[model samples]
Target: MYYIAHRLFAAHDRALAAQLAHHLALKVGEHQVFLPFCDTDEEDLVADIKGRRLFELDRERLRSIRALIAILHGPSPDDGVCMEIGYAAALGAPVILLTTDFQDYSSAPAGPRTVFPDPLLDALATRIVRVPRLGAPAQQPGTSRFANFAARNHAQVQNATEACVEAALQLPLPLPTISVPIRDGSTVYAEPSSYTAPNYALPGRTTIAGVTVLGPTRFEAAEPIPAARHDWAAALSSTRIVVDGSGPETPPGAALLIGAACATGRPVAAYLPRSTYTHATGREPNHRNLMVQYGLEATLRSADEVTAWISG
Candidate 1:
């Protein structure tokens, strides 16, 4: 079965997602495609403990999906979608990225700076399919828009969905083997921009709490970050907490860190602005993505807090 991974927050986004799923079903036959928002219980997503139930539900659903039809839109694609893509790629499932929105609001790569979709995300997907800009078809006038106007017309949407379906049909799944690049671990893994700026620093131990961090290759200075770069997969194994000080005001890059971290059983700790998100858990990280909001262990408020987290 094919899975449609998308954002379901905004009214237009919801409409667009529903529109995509509808179009996809027309081409591939009914009851074959699964859209998360359409299939899952949203009420249960909230009532469950910290949304762990939804997390588990989605993980299991992706495990069985044949291909991932990921909708890439907005300044950045949905973080949940990114996590979905990462999981699908790990399972060796084909990921067909379909986008009607083509604009890069993000910056060039510098430190953890994210681009249109972070290079890391670009690396994971099997292939990308770009559709013509979406807008109401010429015959249709003033389509009711709840949030933002629909960018692509009906015909373009049809074409994009068709292309995605064809691509999914052609790609091979469950490849015999997949290659993943690995980087040696470091005790502390912070962006090059972060180290010089003084967000958090280890007190003295190259090894924290007996975990040979990121693994064995210890870095305590500005120079190491550049060498290590942002290979989150390789780094997460060795690093305890990835300290990202870039809050929403700056639009964090490559969010793959969160995806890769979760995929590999690592905890990502970041300093977030209070303006982002606040929850019943007073110490929860200020994040927009429910996955990040709940999966995150804590928000680092000070160097002492960082040290305390790393040590424990």
Candidate 2:
């Protein structure tokens, strides 16, 4: 059996967690699954906190589980989830951290401060999986909440849940380390010529062995404009032969950098968001245009596809 720990503050989050637990239980049958939110029925009462029954029960559950699967989202994870992760790690269970939110933890900044995964959790995780967002943003008028939630997250939840189960089963799953480029798209329209490589979030199944931010564009202060240009060129020289995320619709300067990468005879690929593709090319994705203009070997749409490509 595996323990799935997730935040249940929001109604949607609770709903999503239930679906994930159910699907995971079905996939890994016979071995019981424990979901904290799903298993516990007692309301959290502050006045009766001294009883400590809930805490004790949770700890016992944590100790018995073979593995822990944690769902992280938003800018940061809830404090309770963080503690649960720590406790599970201390108990020596394998930890699987999954999220779709990508935040750069390695690079120094050229702009404002940003959030990254917690270093402790990052170190503790045995496997990390990135997946696409579960469902559409807008709610249909007649759809029940569970139906709507299921509709949105069914595919991603199933995929992630299966991966978690595989890990629990001690099956081999590839954890590939990838290099990702950082670009600032904030000024794409305001200063089309200005180029700055801010930071990049490398998403994969394992920790990045190392990340070399190509140029003088460390997380600190920026170099002179010319110096920065030199830095951009330098960064490209150190980039991987197969770049995972690069596209022209990024900030203009960043786009040019990607172009430069393509020009270097290296293969550049992008997981083009619908809006980004529309914004960049002003039309739907045409393979011919993607190749001729963006220099992408392939334009991927999901993390699973990207993973298969990287693993391939």
Candidate 3:
């Protein structure tokens, strides 16, 4: 049985939460869910003593949960949801974040300006289920109607719920440990060097499993600038080969690393599983561009391909 955690602040959120709970219960065949505001009424003010008690209760509930599913709706997630994510992570629980905001909110936009999930949430999530915006009003005449709205909303909720359940089922797995540079929108120049020979193996014979940028670093609300840069340098220096997991939306830090690798004659590879490529870039990967611009030695399509490259 899985214990799903979610927020239920507004009317629509409550309704969606109920639907999600029902769907998840059906999918798991005997599961418990924590929907905040389901049992308690919203209050504008509460006594300090009572508030403390409520906080304790919420934490207790959070502790018992096996998985956490945070519903994010805008450019930023709710403060409560962020706290919940931190709590769940501290407890070593897998977190699945469902969000409709899928746009790159960075200063330097990577790809299309479509709605994208928050970078920090994407980094922390055990799985991220990106769903369409619920209740998007039809624009044309004869297109907007009560029936159509109801049907569309119901379908969106159902699809998102199913995705959440699938993510929940895959829980309790170890999170991937990757190192990549963080892009800070700084200018990085490629240096010419004589070390043109490729170095894919480290002194101790270590190979990079994958490379991913520190997304949270770009958000001032997420981490401090100094720390984020420190992490980026650490990730780059520690690995033999740096894998580009950022797709075409390469962060400045990752791009810097690519140039550094080229200057030092270290091999850099691109890894884009079909699902990831489609979800991130919303189209087929431009392999030729990645190889030419980034000095990438190869564009890998799967874990097996990456493994082969590492082995060879």
Per-model TM against the reference: 0.68, 0.45, 0.49
lDDT of 3 by residue, 1-312 (tens): 244444444678777777777777776654366655553333432444433444455656766667778776764344345546645543556778776553445434442232223333444556778876665554556765876787767767777888877777777555443333443232121211111221222223222333322222333333334433443344344333444343334333333344345434456554544322211122224332221233556666665675566545
Ranking by TM-score: 1, 3, 2
> lDDT: which candidate is best?
1
Span of ten consecutive residues with least summed lDDT in model 3: 186-195
Per-residue lDDT of candidate 2, residues 1-312 (tens digit):
577777755776777667667777777763577877456543433323322444455667876666778787754454345546645554456678777664644334444332323233454567776664665643678878888777666666667666655665663344233233343221111011112231233322232333322223322333233343444435344433223233332332323334344434344454443323211212333332222233455655655554444444
Score each candidate by Cα lDDT: 0.57, 0.48, 0.49
Tell me which residue pairs clash in candidate 3: 101-116, 102-115, 102-116, 102-117, 103-115, 103-116, 183-252, 183-253
What TM-score does prediction 3 earn?
Answer: 0.49
Ranking by lDDT: 1, 3, 2
Residue-by-residue lDDT tens digits, candidate 1, 184-288: 344545432221343445433456666444421213322332322444445543544454535442222224455555555566675552436534442233356
RMSD of 1: 6.5
lDDT of 1 at 17: 71
Q: Model 2 TM-score?
A: 0.45
| TM value for model 1 | 0.68
